[model samples]
Target chain A: MPAGKFTQDELDQIYAFAVDLGRKAGDLLMERVEQRIDGSDAPQTFEEKENAVDIVTQTDEDVEVFIRDAIHTKYPTHKFLGEESYAKGESREYLLDAQPTWCIDPLDGTVNYTHLFPMYCVSIGFVVDNLPVIGVIYAPFQNQLFSACNGRGAWLNEKRRLPLIRNPIPPMPANAPSQCIFSCEWGKDRRDIPDGNMHRKIESFVNMAAEIGGREGKGGMVHGIRSLGSATLDLAYTAMGSFDIWWEGGCWEWDVAAGIAILLEAGGLITSANPPDDFDTASIPDVKLGSRLYLAIRPAGPSATESGRESQERTVREVWRRVRQLSYSRPGA
Target chain B: MPAGKFTQDELDQIYAFAVDLGRKAGDLLMERVEQRIDGSDAPQTFEEKENAVDIVTQTDEDVEVFIRDAIHTKYPTHKFLGEESYAKGESREYLLDAQPTWCIDPLDGTVNYTHLFPMYCVSIGFVVDNLPVIGVIYAPFQNQLFSACNGRGAWLNEKRRLPLIRNPIPPMPANAPSQCIFSCEWGKDRRDIPDGNMHRKIESFVNMAAEIGGREGKGGMVHGIRSLGSATLDLAYTAMGSFDIWWEGGCWEWDVAAGIAILLEAGGLITSANPPDDFDTASIPDVKLGSRLYLAIRPAGPSATESGRESQERTVREVWRRVRQLSYSRPGA
Candidate 1:
């Protein structure tokens, strides 16, 4: 009944089970896609939520129900939190409280799925005492499986270390704007401009891309921005170093839990996308899903010299400052 | 000795031959990429032109030379225009003047290729009397070959009729802002905000993405924007219907020649990104490579009803009207 009480064998078993379940679910996704290649697969079964721009389909729900049932039947005591079950307040209760909590997004990047885009995936994670202990993300389209267990290291296809590229790389110039490859997405919350905040969100999005220091340019002008439409792949790719950093907000805990475990297990750093000035990225453990933000940094290459990590830190710090106001800071923060 | 003199069979023969050359060159590109997988390929052999953001690699030069030699040896009477030969004003002489002209991009999306991003490709176009008679764009990563000969319809992998998704699709809702998926890229020209035509370019970019209809939202708040980092893939994907629309300017003629042929052959329509009043989407013949701007639309579905094409044309017209001032016209035009 204590935090971190599970033995190493127990952790490994859970990881193996999750990987199997995730992969099976991923296969199910692929099968449905293959069956519907004609643009006529259960077209009526798709529904829009929050906004027509956001969508969910029968496949998403079917896969979630299947995974939930399998994991619950196998480990009934484990608290399960999934995207489909978000209305049940599953996202808010992150405390593991001596029992394991399984966090999952049966199908992340639902919009991309509807558009037949290639980056959607199945993300599964196991948490204990509010800490993600096991993670597995399966991108079925590309047949890529990214996984990691706490303290056991990370691997792709059960081989090779995390951060596809080795360390000792050069830093982005200054905030390393044009040299940095950043990935972010426009979530279902599009009313931010007219109904909610005073154009902070859209303005921020534009600024990050505007001329570095021009009148309307408050953004970092990074090398590029990818709206890959899949948070799970975004994080999985970041964990793999396919992407340098991923900044996001307004997504649920399950959307990032699995990928976060893989990221941190591989020695990557994460925090609120809009952390405070005193925020120490090294203290990633303090960050919580409730923050409604996820800013993940790739690990320095394995071969990077000691100074390599230092340079990356400086760059990350500068980026943090530039994006400090990204979040809707609660009126008078 | 007249314009448009080539027969359908001649056009087809040229098409078949260019596909072969493009694929061969794509294979050579892959070989070079594999050899430099470790960020070590011709590391210093890259030279910048115009600016540091615009670069030329050894592989680019090598591929251009190889294609030029092969084509010249076989068709000594043809006038060949290539990116590598741009310094000699090869791009300026667009007039066909009886002799056939081969316009080729040895390497398109050089930035993505150098970054190993996997979206770059080789684009080859053949023109007879100023008409794009044959086109081939080969993307080696996905092994997808897109080709179009003037009258012979466009094909992907020589099979599927393009604009990947069949359409008779609904138009974007009035507030349909985020329902439309659009793509635009940030090219090497960063000074477009300063030294250029008074920030018209950046302002237009900001407008398209601005909060839909907000006082600041002068643009279509489309579903999302993707900067895939490659023009060839951008056009290739546009041809495949992976993207609904693509808007670009300032890129070389060779950059679009092949994709343009494929787009037209596929029945897709293209016009300047910002056309004059009374510019007809149906009159695509008036648009030329020298225009320096392109706005391409996805075509109706292959099996679309007669009304389907009309609906598509309507949508294109609306989009064009909304984007009338996209480019900075010289003074008052």
Candidate 2:
């Protein structure tokens, strides 16, 4: 074990705790959903965040409070950062230090929750030295649980090891985008400026979906584009090999931290959503948890000409070239 | 019983048969999926329909053949219309007459099917006098079965009656778009003309997702936009109250006939995806099975000022005005 780091046993314990906590949070969400559906719930109310499209509900707050308390009671010395608490804080600082911190998004799909869309989930990530090491995500409506500990591999329902088809993951095609099932979101930012984040995002989506040789030669014509409205679940699905590519912007650390750990453990790659300065470079930099920009690709199988990492790198570069670069800034950055 | 129509008992029998057939087709699909995932499936091959994005696989054809044969054997006099047969036919006529016909998309969401995305399903619809009277859709991966019989009701797994929250489904808000979870797809038509069908579709999507008071008053600021790549499943979700609205174009009758029957039975409304000639009319024209354009809204809760149908109609008009009218023509139309 590293000098200041927890060993394998401790990490497994943390992963187990987070998985249980995630399921508990998911139960709370299901209860609230039942109340809302059965007409026994309190007054229906939602507080707008960035705009009407971005909203928060009482359930989100309540569940976050419960998760925070549970974590604090179990590990009193660990720092905490959650979506609700961060939104309520006065300072609004972006802080991720060397100490262990639990990143929690009690309800990742708040709008889906309010609308009863059944894609929402609870995401809990334990971060050490600013890197997600233990991740657990539970989608109760689908009864799917995804968790991963660093170097321990990702699992679905603690039963199936992921990439779900791990025996020989298919090698990404030469023209990656043409065969890719891309996952992206129309994020909280709704500005329609000509080349603003929203405009660029939509343009990127169009470029990817448009026919080949169209859009001034920018079209990639991906197999399909899906927006499930929950970053955590999107990454979890990508990890399990259902979705081939996930590109996102304007999401927070709590929204992606757990999914990132799981995805990485499942042999996936995460890079900056934005285009790099040099396309000729062999490697692209990994996106930071708070970068608010990300592009993830599932692990590739054995290829005669290219290794799995090379295939993933080629995909990232090819995709980056097709879609318009997007810019999303943190609240205080 | 009407002179030319099947009696209630006959319709119920047909419904039961369709449900059984749907489950069998779903089982075939699941087996093929397992074979593909485990690397034991036959050599992968897909035939292009209109273009690269539009594809048909061997499994799709095989499932359709199995279903068609079963239907013809049981109901010798009934007509049949299915996606594969239609594509293979030379006439390519848009035919929906007075005859009793079985409309089947043996496998909807073929792209999802090939990609193992789990949103694919088997949709079986029975149409009489150009109206869908019985609907059955089964998603093997999700193990969900949605079915309905005209004048009877829609059901999930033949148990839970839909809107899923039937006690009192929520009424559409005064400003529906601001709070709606809209569903649309980037269909096979991927041209990039400035004001063409694909262009307008993209523009409408942007308008629906943009910030309020933006995009020249076309901004809808909807809570979310989801694309599941499966029209049948989309309509099923909307019928069950998970999605607020669904607008689609370029899909065939086999894609939506079953969903239409289910949605109508669930107390929802369907209108043309294109705008009407007179918005002031008391009732909008119901879209035909072969319209190539459709708009669907979930059933609304009881309201003092307006009935559920009225509320749904209002939402249809509101959404029609927000999205650009797309043009989708059938073969030889």
lDDT of each: 0.68, 0.87
Docking class of 1: acceptable
Considering every candidate listed, which one attains the maximal lDDT?
2
Candidate 2: the clashing residue pairs are none
lDDT of each residue in B181-204, candidate 1, tens digit only = 566666655552553532444445
- lDDT string for model 1 (A1-333, tens) is 222888888888888899899899999998887565556654324676765556778888999999999998999878987787764342344333446889889998776666555568999988887678789998786677889998788877677566544433333244454455677776555552443432444444444554566434445655556667778878887776656667777776788889889988876777777646665454433457545677777665422333545555655565565563454322111
Candidate 1 local lDDT, residue B331: 18
The candidate that achieves the highest TM-score relative to the unseen native structure: 2
DockQ, candidate 2, comes to 0.69
- Angstrom error at residue B305, model 2: 1.9
RMSD of each: 4.8, 2.0
Interface RMSD of 1: 3.7
